[model samples]
Target: MQFQIENIPIQEVKLDFAKDVRLFVKREDLIHPFVSGNKFRKLTYNLAEANKEKQDTLLTFGGAYSNHIAAVAAAGKLHGFKTIGIIRGEELVRKVDSNPTLCFAVENGMQLKFVTRENYRKKTSEEFLTQLTEEFGRFYTVPEGGTNDLAVKGCAEIITENEKDFDTICCAVGTGGTISGICNGAYSHQQILGFPALKGDFLQKEISQYTSKENWQLMNDYHFGGYGKVSEELVTFINQFKQQTGIPLDPIYTGKMLFGIIDLIKNGHFAKQNRILAIHTGGLQGIEGMNQKLQRKGQKTII
Candidate 1:
C-alpha cells in the first residue's frame, strides 16, 4: 500500500525581528495528528518496505516520553501492522497510565516492553536484536528516532522546488535524519543549519553517514541543557510564540530550534536580506507529558 502524505504548507512567521530577514515555517506537523512531521516522513517508505517484505509487525525503541514511540504505534494501527515498543526505563511500565505518550501508544494497540536503560543502549547491537527477534517472532525494526536510509529518503522530499529560493534551511536535529535529508535535497546555494536538541558531538558524524552534502552545519549552543530538558524561559517563549504566531511548538525540538533561529537573527548571525525556512518537525504530542512534569516541579507549563 502506498503511504499518502499531505502537501506540507509553508507559512511566513510574522514576528518582530530583523527587518532584512524573512522567516517562514513548513507545517509538517499538519500531516497527521499522531503520525505527523518528520515521523510521518520517516515512516513513509519504511511502511511500504514492510508491506513489501510481508512483515506483519513493526518493532522500535524509545524513552518514556518518546514521540517516535507514539508515532510508530499510530502508524502501525493505521497501516494494519502489530507494533512493539521497547521502551527504556523499566519503572515506566507501571506509569503508562499517567504518561500521555505511552498511554496513547497502548490505546493505539501497541505492545509495550520496558527495559533497563543499559539494555536500551544496546538496541542497535546484533545480540540485542537477535534476542528481540527470538522473543517477538518476526518484526520489521525501525531504529530509535525513526531514522534510517529510507527515513532520510522520505525526509529529502521535505525540500521541494518551492523551497529552492530560500537562502538557509533550519531544523531541529535528533538522530540527524531530518537535517541530513534536507541537506541532500537543498539547492547548492542554500545553507542548512541544524539545532540539535541534545548536547553531542556525535550528531555531526551521524548526519554525515546519511548525506555527503557539505552545505550543512550544526548549532550546538541552544540545547538548553540537553535532551528532554527545558526551562521556564523556553516555556515562556513557546507560549508567547504561539499567542503571537498561532503556531504551537513542543518544548523538545521545534521550540528550541526556533528559539535559536530568532536569537541568531537578533545577534546579526545571518546576512542581510537572508530568507530562512525552518522545518517544523512536530512533537506536539509530547506537550501534555511535559506539562505534567512541569506541574510536578512547580514550573510553568506549555500553553
Candidate 2:
C-alpha cells in the first residue's frame, strides 16, 4: 500500500471508569515521521500555496525544540524548497548540537537564524517581517506553529464521514489552529473540547478568529504549567500510558490531553454513554529535547 497522509484510523482507548463512554483517539501521529499530526495538517495547504506562488524558499519561526521547525525543515527537503528557521532563544544557536529539533532542522538543510525571545515576539509585526524580507529576500513565510488560513483549511479535513459518529471531539490545543479546524469540520451537534498545553484564557480569542462556530470550549486546567512545562506526574503518566495502550504520546501535547480526558471522565465531565474522539496531534520528535531538559533538572526522563 502506498503511504498517504489522510484517512488515519481511530484507536479505541480502554478506560475502566469510562466504560459507559466510548473513548477513541484519531491516530494523527501516524501521519508522518516528522510532519505528523497537526503539523502535517497545518502544512499541507501552506506548502501548496507556496508552490503555487513559485516560491523557492520557505521561512518560518519556532523555538529550539519546536515540532513545527522540524516539520518545516523536513517538508522543505521532501518538497524541494529551501527552508529558513527563525528560531527563538538566540542562545540556541550555540547549543544546536544539544537540541534535537534544531539539529534535525539543520541536518535537513534548513538555514537556522537565531533571535532573542523578545525579538521573536515581533515575528508577526510588519516591521519585523520587513526586516526578515530584507534579510532573506522573497520567501513564503509560515507563522510560528503553522496556524494560518491555509493551515486551518487543511486541519478542517481532520473530521470526515468516518468521525461523524463521535459525539464529542477532543485534541491538544497549542496555537488553537487545529481545534479551530476541528470546530469547522465537526458536526453541528458535536462538542469540541480543547485541552490546552499552556495555561491561559487567551487562546479562546485566537481560536475565534478562524471559525465562527461556538461548538468548542477549552479545558484550562490540564496544562501542567505553561508551554514546554511538565511535571514528574505527567512523565509517569505518559510512560504508563504507553505501556498500557502501546501508544507513545509526546509529553507536551497528546499526553496531557489524554491525562485530562481521563481525569475529566472520573469527575463526570461527560454524560453517560457519550462518545469521544481525541486527536493525537504529534510532537513525538520533541521528546528527545524534552528529555534533555528533564535530565538537566535531575528529573525522571520520559521513556
> Model 2, range 1-303, lDDT digits (tens) per residue?
223655788999888766679899999889888888999899989999999999999999998889999999999998999999999898877898878898899999999999999999999999999999999899999999999999999999999999989999999999999999999999878999999999878898999999999999899998998898999999999999999888999999999999999899898999988999999998999899899999999999999
Model 2: how large is the Cα RMSD against the reference? 1.3
Give the TM-score of each candidate.
0.98, 0.97
Q: What local lDDT score does residue 297 receive in model 2, on the 0 to 100 scale?
A: 94
1-303 per-residue lDDT for model 1 (tens digits): 333355568999985757989999998898888898999999999999999999999999999899999999999999899999999999998999999999999999999999999999999999999999999999999999999999999999999988988999999999999998999988999999999999979998899999999999999999999999999999999999999999999999999999999999999999988999999999999999999999999999999
Clashing pairs in 1: none
RMSD of each: 1.5, 1.3
Worst 10 residues of 2 by lDDT: 1-10
lDDT of 1 at 210: 99
Stretches of candidate 2 exceeding 4 Å from the true structure: 1-3
- lDDT of model number 2: 0.92
The TM-score of predicted model 2 comes to 0.97
Candidate 2, residue 96: the lDDT equals 88
